[model samples]
Target: MPKFAVVVCPHCKNAFIMEPGHKTVSCRSCNKRLEASRLKVFFASDDFKEAQAARGSVVAGISGDTAAFEEALPGIGRDVMERIGEDVQEQRYMEDKRKVNEKMDEEARKTKKKGQQAILRDTFEELAENGDIDIEEYWKKISFSGIDRLKFDKWVEKLVETGVAYSPRFGYLRKS
Candidate 1:
């Protein structure tokens, strides 16, 4: 097997492992043709895996990540790899949580635009106990619906006109 060499491309500065003895090699990143003999070699090894590790170190160094470059060196241990796996998992978890929150926000916006008075009416219906809604309780529950008292009164008037609800007394309303 031809011994592999870890080299950096002069044009793009990206590192990659390649075999020696070739007259020319194309840079993996920039695709520029370079004379193999002229290219600066960072490391050379008979083992392809060792050359790959050296290439990783060179790439990490080029990216300005010191920790990753150090991890690419031999005798780093499996604990570092495990930590990288955990970090990736945590990133994915956070991304998933953000997506869920965005979806909930979108759903809330759709519900908010559906019609405030309609939501308030539904809330009033839900607030009704024993088939009669206490005006005070209904007002308290629909506070978040953004419907003002005048608007609610007009809506209630419309409801009574449309035969959907009726005022049984001064402080209670019931659906007809």
Candidate 2:
């Protein structure tokens, strides 16, 4: 078996060399993600220099040079003019499963954000009492406010500075 393959991009018809074993490769010229097992291996060789020369020949052949193509065709040791069709079925199933998982993750994130916003809007100031507040409790009540812990701490500091609220202790707040 060859360590490297000279394959042509099915989308752009450009030739490039790649190592096998990976599930996919991005076409160098077209920037398209290609399943490596599905591409036609134009030439295969264990030597990188040999693969490069084969790629050059494939490029020349695509550029309308029939003589270069004919010369290169004879050098293909095995599976000449055949698709590298190993694991094609399994690859299709995995690709579909990956896309479905991504979509489910996105939907989960969106639903969680909306639920957090509703919780904050409903329960925020209800946790306060008698013009005094627990900073940690307030932060928990407003978790959907999209402010992280550091930002909440900075907000508390700003409130104290502006006389809107004051911190009498490290974790307590009072209205001014």
Candidate 3:
């Protein structure tokens, strides 16, 4: 038995484990074979460094006084900052929804199901009618095994592909 760490294939971009003593493995994404020695280990320490670098880059890019935004506004209490944050979040949500709709429209033009479209349509319709669809709850209701999340995601992708469901501001919504 050899120790292994999950690595993303540079050639195909698929995630695969790098087993010790194995020099190469086929990528699950593009099926391109990649050398294990070329893979980079993304450990917690590496992740921390990456986060720190990203934060530093963002801070460096901002020219104005970042502290000014942190100060409390006139006639508003501590909740003012929270409210602004919420508003910004809502804007981001709307932007993301627009992008999803565009992606769904594009996917609908494609001619193939990729094997999960029917199931996805049923699930999306059910969720749209109910106005709520928690992944865990859906799994429980359907009696899915632990591995079913992958299947569910695939189905969701198909639904998106067929333009039957689009993740909007609050949750998944059907195209009207």
Candidate 4:
């Protein structure tokens, strides 16, 4: 057989076979124009095919005859299985890291929420005790950091909704 080349389009993910003389081809999936001149194709030799077959049979003996498993073992089935095992281990490690990050994020959110509520409550109590409140001055005295802007806005909105804060002539006042 003449050494035909197979090209897979990255944009449309279509696979096509081309002969030696063909310089360009279009992808069937996206119907987009493509140049086949730069396409590179690699084919396994007969020796490789035999090795793959032997590996497949050995894997079959271990895993039993599953159609999906058989279909996956095209060449170097043992190497494929070893790679899959490594991939699974890496995936598990990544999943554990993901869970840890999620937990840390949750804890940080809770701490931030609690601190916001405490600040709001303390500010209200101080104004009430003094019998004179300056909204701008009070806000200026308070500091908010280490909190995400969106989360902080949400917390402030919740306080306003619950009558914990209200707009005054100057800026904002705490509800008594």
Candidate 5:
């Protein structure tokens, strides 16, 4: 299933919906880069309504506080009166999506990439032809260094998880 998140774009000072876990988001309004980690959480309409209704009570609670809070109120007021209003929260959700778009202007840019495990699995299929293959011999044939042996093991583990490859025995592999 697809997952989504609502976020406020600090670059454009606008609200936009986005998928979480992106390294960067291009602001639709300003076309500026927005680091997903720096994005602000957007409140839903219902939450906005509730906050609006409770704004008076929140001020009341703050005003009715002790002298220490009274001293802090000035700083809060400065932040509030800074000629802008925005609420930022840090929340992360996990999901995967791929976006392709065409527009009135130029063509869209996409940088899709294959994962390492998929590449290794493809190599297995091409070289071994689905037969039982010795792992060390295969790596030697490919001319990969000794350091890559551990990394290759990790890649094979990922391939096994995807149901595309399997370890039939110690130091041996076959397509699933």
Candidate 6:
């Protein structure tokens, strides 16, 4: 047989019924997250009658009457509370780390794009001033600045994309 117990959401002070082992539920009234494991169950036994008198008041155990409720609710152990705290802290830490990583990745992409734009600008200026695409001379000009020949080649591709310059022959650039 399905058993039902009167329980209240610890988060929102909303009273609701729950199965004995239903460990999570959402509050209908406030829509706040409710830990069903934290829900105080009402026992039909007379031993709990005095404790259940002010049902709503005792529901959350946060309304300054927690000592009596804790004495009655011995099933919720100290370790469980500790584990819950640790879990919440760990979850927050992981979320913070993920946000930091995403920000770093975005910043890295922006930096790389800026570097590429700088390379494009320098290559364009060199080509414009020289008017003749001496590919070797251009490499020698930028080599000491740590720009490799392959990097210059990629920038030359960008120049071709700009429609202001093109390769009329292999190893040569001509103004268009």
Looking at model 1, report the run of 10 residues with the lowest lDDT sum.
80-89
Q: lDDT by residue for model 1 over 1-176, one digit each (tens)?
A: 45998777767767788899999999988999999999776667787877777677666666657688768866434554344334334544665698899999999988876778578767866765469887777777776768788877777678778988889998778888
Cα TM-score per model: 0.41, 0.40, 0.26, 0.38, 0.30, 0.41
What lDDT tens digits, residue by residue, belong to model 5 across residues 33-151? 88877765432223333333223222323234334323433423444322112222111111111112233122312211234444555567786784888887767654443235677
Compare candidates 3 and 6 on lDDT and give the better one. Answer: 6
Which lDDT value does model 3 have at 12?
42
Pairs with steric clashes in candidate 4: none
What shift in Å separates residue 145 of candidate 1 from its native position after superposition? 80
lDDT of 3 by residue, 29-85 (tens): 788877867765421122333333322322222222335434423333445344443
Computed on alpha carbons, the lDDT of every model, listed in order, comes to: 0.73, 0.69, 0.49, 0.54, 0.50, 0.59
* Residue 24 local lDDT, model 1: 99
Model 6, span 1-176: residue lDDT tens: 22555555545545555456566777777887677777555422233333343233334343444455445444544653343334434544665698899999999989877776676567657675767677776676666765667877878787789886888888777778
Displacement of the residue 36 alpha carbon in candidate 1, Å: 0.8
Clashing residue pairs for model 6 = none
Cα displacement (Å) at residue 2, model 1: 6.3
What residue pairs are clashing in model 1?
none
Q: Where is model 1 more than 4 Å wrong at Cα? A: 75-176
Candidate 6 has a TM-score of 0.41
Location of the lowest summed lDDT over 10 successive residues in candidate 5: 89-98
Off by over 4 Å in 2: 70-176
TM-score of candidate 5 versus the correct structure, residues matched by position:
0.30
Across 1-116, the per-residue lDDT of candidate 4 in tens digits comes to: 44444444546434445455666677767877776666433222235444344334333423435454446456555664454434333444665698899999999989877887
110, model 4: CA deviation in Å? 3.0
